[model samples]
Target chain A: MSDAEIAVRDLTIRYGQHVALKGASFEVRPHEIFGIIGPANSGKTSFLKVLNRMDTFTAGMHFEGQVEVGGRDVRAWRNLYALRRQIGVVFPLPVGLPLSVYDNVAFAPRLAGVRAKADLNVIVEGCLRRAALWDEVKDRLNALGSLLSGGQQQRLTIARALSQKPRILLLDEFSIAVDPVTTMRIEAVLSELKAEMTIVLVTNLVQQARRLADRTAFFLMGECVTVAPTEQFFLRDADLDPRARDYVEGRFG
Target chain B: MSAPPPHPDTAALDRRDLAWYVDKLVAVLVFVGGVSAVVFIVGIFAFVTHEGWGFVSEHFSLRGFFGSIRWAPTSTSNPTYGALALIAGTASVTGLAMLVAVPFSLGAAIYIAEFATGRTREVLKVLVEMLAAIPSVVWGFIGLSVMNPLIIDVFNVPIGLCVLNSGLILGLMAAPIMTTIAEDALKAVPDTYREAAEALGATRWQVTRRVVLPAARQGLLAAVLLGVGRGFGETMAVLMASGHAINLPTSPFDSVRALTATIAAELGETAVGSTHYQALFALGIFLFVVTFVINLSADLIVRGIRKT
Candidate 1:
C-alpha cells in the first residue's frame, strides 16, 4: 500500500525435502532499508537469495507462491538478465573474483554493456567511493581483489554490487567477517545509498537492525513472525510477538 | 597457587604412541615409493647420456645437429647424423596435432563444465575418459586402415601416410588428456563466482568466457602443455601412422619421421655401441629433454594455480 518496491505473498522455499522458508509474506517500500534478523536456520539469507533468483544456481531448490519485483512477477519474467540487472546481491563471505580490484568492480558494468574504458573508470571509482573503499584501494586498483583484508574485501563486494546500478541491493550477513569499525562504516554507506535504492539487509545481529533499518522483519524457524517499524518493534509495544521480543533482547535464539 | 597435577593417562599415551608409530611407518613407506620414481628417472637419464657420450664426443658437431639438412643415417660410407629434419618433422606434426586438439578440447571442456548437466554430463565425461584408455596402437590402426584411404580420396594424394595423417591421429590421442585436465580446471572454479557473475546480469556464456576462463587460465595452460608433452612422447602411434621417411617435410602432406618414430623404427636393429646406435640414444636424450621441459613447466603452472 505504501508503494512497495518488492512484494512477497505467501512465499515458501525448499531444498529437496527440507523447507528453508515457509509461507512468508512481506513488502519492502522504495528507498527504505528493510532489515531481516533471525537465528541460524531461520531462512534470513535464503530470503535474500530468492530476491535475485540466486537460489536457481543451487540444485533442487523449490519455491511456491509469488514474488513481485518492481511490479512484475519474478516467475513470469522471461528475460533473466533484465531481471537480475535490477537486483544485486552481496554474499555472506566476500568472494572477490580472483581479479584485480578495478576489474572486480568493472566486471558488472562491462557485463551490463559498458565497453568504453573511460565510462568504466568513472563508474568503478564512483561505486568504490560509495562503498567506502576508494580511499584504501585508489592507489592499488591493479592489485588482486583477493589480496585485500576481510573488511576491505567485503566493501569491494559492496562496490561490485553497486556497479550494476541496481534498483535494489540485497546483503546477506555482510558484516559476519567484518570488524566492528568497518561494519559501522558500511552501515553509514548503506544509509546514504538508501536515497537512491531499496536495501535488504539480512543480519544475525539485532543491534545492527535496530541502528540501520527503517522497517524490520523478524523470522523464526523459517517463518516471518512480524514486520513493523524499527522504532515500534524495538520499543516493545504490546503488538510485538513474544518470540521476536525474546530474540531482540537476547533471551534466547 | 601451584599448577594443577597432571591426570593419569599413561595407558592412553602408550596406545597413542602405537598408532603414531604405525602412521610413521606408513608415511616412510610412501616416502620411499615417491623417492624411487626420482631414482629410476635419474638412472635412465644417466644410462642414456652415458651410452650417447661417445658419439657426441666424436661425431657430434653443431653443424650436423642443427645446421645440416639431410637425415640419412644409414649410408654405408658416409652416414649423416644430422637431426634438423627429424626435429622439424617432430615440431610440425606436434604443432599440427595441437592445432587440431586445442579448439576441440577447449570446446568440449566448456560444454562439459558449463552446459552439460546430470546424466548427459556424466556420460560425456566417461566417454572422454574412455577415449584416453584406447590403446595408441588402435588409434594408429584406425589411421592406417580408415583415415589414410579417406585422406587419399579427399585430397588426391598418392600416399596418405604423411604428416597430416600422423598429426590427425596424434590429435585424437591427445584430445582426451586435454579435455580431462581442462574440464577439471573449469569445474574447480567455485559456484560462488558463477553466482556472482549471474547476479550482475551476465549470461552463462559470458560468465564462462569472462570469469571462469580467466580464473582457470593457468590450469588451462598446464592442460595444453601436458597435451603437447603427451603428443611429443607418443611412439607406436606415430611410428605406425607416419610414413617414417627421414625427410624434411615441406608441407603437411609430405611424409616425415618424428624423433620417437625414428627411435622405434631403427633402435631395435641398430648395432650396439655403433655411431648409429649412439645417435639414436642422442635422439632419445633430445626427446627426454623436450618432454621433460614441457612437463616441468606444466607442473610449475599447476603449482602456481594451486598456490593462488
Candidate 2:
C-alpha cells in the first residue's frame, strides 16, 4: 500500500443496473507508466473516472470497493477539488476549451491560485514546451484554442493537463483524433513524464502498452484479465492468460 | 459465373412518380411560407411610413420631434408635437428594466443550466416558460393593483404609478423570456468543455464562470438585447403602470409616458387623418424602427457566434 501510488482492491463501477467494470484489483507503482489496453465498452474509461471521483457527477454511476491514491482512499478526501488536483485526465478526443490557446493551458494553474502574470507565463510556456506544442503556437497564443488543428489541440489538452502538476495523469485514448507524427511526439512527452508522476494510459492500441508501460494490464469484458511486467506480459511462451495473449497478438479485440 | 440479370430500364427508373410531384408541391408551399415573412415585414413598414408621411412632410421638424419636450398638439393657437419627454420616459424605463432583469435572468439561467439536474431542471425550465406566457395585460393588472400599493408603501412616495412601478412590471415581464433564452445559450455550450475544465481541478462555479459563461457570451448578450426589445415594444403593461403622463422623468419616482403607451392611449380619440393622429403613427414608426434595430443586432450577434 505504501509503495503503490494508486491501489485498487475489488473495485466495481455500475451505471444503474449495468456493471461497467467488476471486482478489479491492481496497483500502479509511484513514478511508473501503467497501461490499460482494451476494446470499446471494456470499462477502461470508467476505471479512469473512478480514480479521480468523476463518477460523482455522472448520473446513476455507483462505485464500490476501494480506490486509493497516495495511500488514502479517494472517497476519504473531503474536498473533491483537492482530490482531482492530484489526478489529471485527458479524454478520448481533444477538447479545446472555448478560450485562447494561452488561457487553455493556463486554466488549471489559475484554478490552483497561480495569480502572478510572470508565474503563469512561465508555467504556460513550460507545459506547452513539454507537451511539444510551444514552438507551433508561441506566435499566436492569443488565438482561440479550438481554432488549432486537431493534432495541435490534442497537444494543448496535454499541456492543460500538465499545468495542474498532478501526481497521477490519466489519458483515455488521446491519440484518437491526433495524427501519427503528433502521436509519436506525445508518446515521447509521456515517456519523459514517467519520472515525475504515475500515469494510467488507457489505449485501444495494444502495442502501445508494450512500448511505454513498465507493467501493463489487459481489461476484457468488464474484468481485469491480467496484469504483468511488460517483459513477462509479452513473452512468447510465458504461460499467459490465453485471452490476454490472443488480444495482444492481434487475434481478436 | 452465371448469366447476368437484365438491367432495369433507365427511363423507367428515372420516371417522375406521385411522390416527386408531392415533394415539389411541398417545396413550393414551404418556399411561399418563408418568403411571406419578409413580405409581411415590408408591408407593415410600408403601411406605417405611409400613414406617418403626411405629418412628417407637413408638420414635422427634427428639433421639435426629438429635442423639444412640449407635446401639445391641441393648443388651438400653439400646437407643439415634441416627443423628447416620451422618448426619455421610454429609455429610462427600459434602462431600469434591464438593470432589474439582467441579474435575475442570468442567475436563473446559470442555476438551471449548471446546478439543477433531472426533474428539478425540467420543472424549472417549464416554470420559466410558463412565466413568459403570462399575459402582459395581466402583468399590468398586477402592477396597477399589487405593485402600485407596494411601491407607495415601501418608498413612501406620494404616487406609485411612476417609472419605478412600470420598470419593475416591465422587468418582471421581460425576465422570463430572458431566462429561457439565456438558459438555451448556456445549454448550447458543449458538456465536454465542462468535463475538461473539471478534470483540471476546477470547481463547478469556476468552470461555469471561466469556461461556460465565456463560451455563451454572445448568446447571452443576444438574450439581453431581446429582453430590451421586449421592454421597448411593450404597450399595455407600460400604458397601465407608467401613469400615462408625458414627462421627462428625472427620477424613478417621477411619472413618465412611453412611446407605445402614447399610441395605445391617444390613437382612437384623435381624428383619423388629423395631425395628432398622424403624429401617433409617427411614434409607432419610431417604436418599429428601434425594436427592428435591436432585434436585427441580436440576430447578427447570434449569427456571429455560429460562424466562430
TM-score of each: 0.94, 0.97
Residue B132 error, candidate 2, Å: 0.4
Assess the local accuracy of residue B285 in candidate 1 as a C-alpha lDDT between 0 and 100. Answer: 90
lDDT of 1 by residue, B33-68 (tens): 999999999999999999999888999999988788
For model 1, residues A125-229, the per-residue Cα lDDT tens digits are 999999999999999999999999999999999999999999999999999999999999999999999999999999998889999999999999999999999
Query: How good is the docking of model 1, as DockQ?
Result: 0.73
- The two-chain DockQ for each candidate, comma-separated, is 0.73, 0.82
DockQ of 2: 0.82
Question: Candidate 2: which pairs clash?
Answer: none
Residue range B139-186, candidate 2, lDDT tens digits: 999989998999899999988999999999999999999999999999
List where candidate 2 sits over 4 angstroms from the true fold: B1-15
**What is each predicted model's overall lDDT from 0 to 1?**
0.91, 0.93
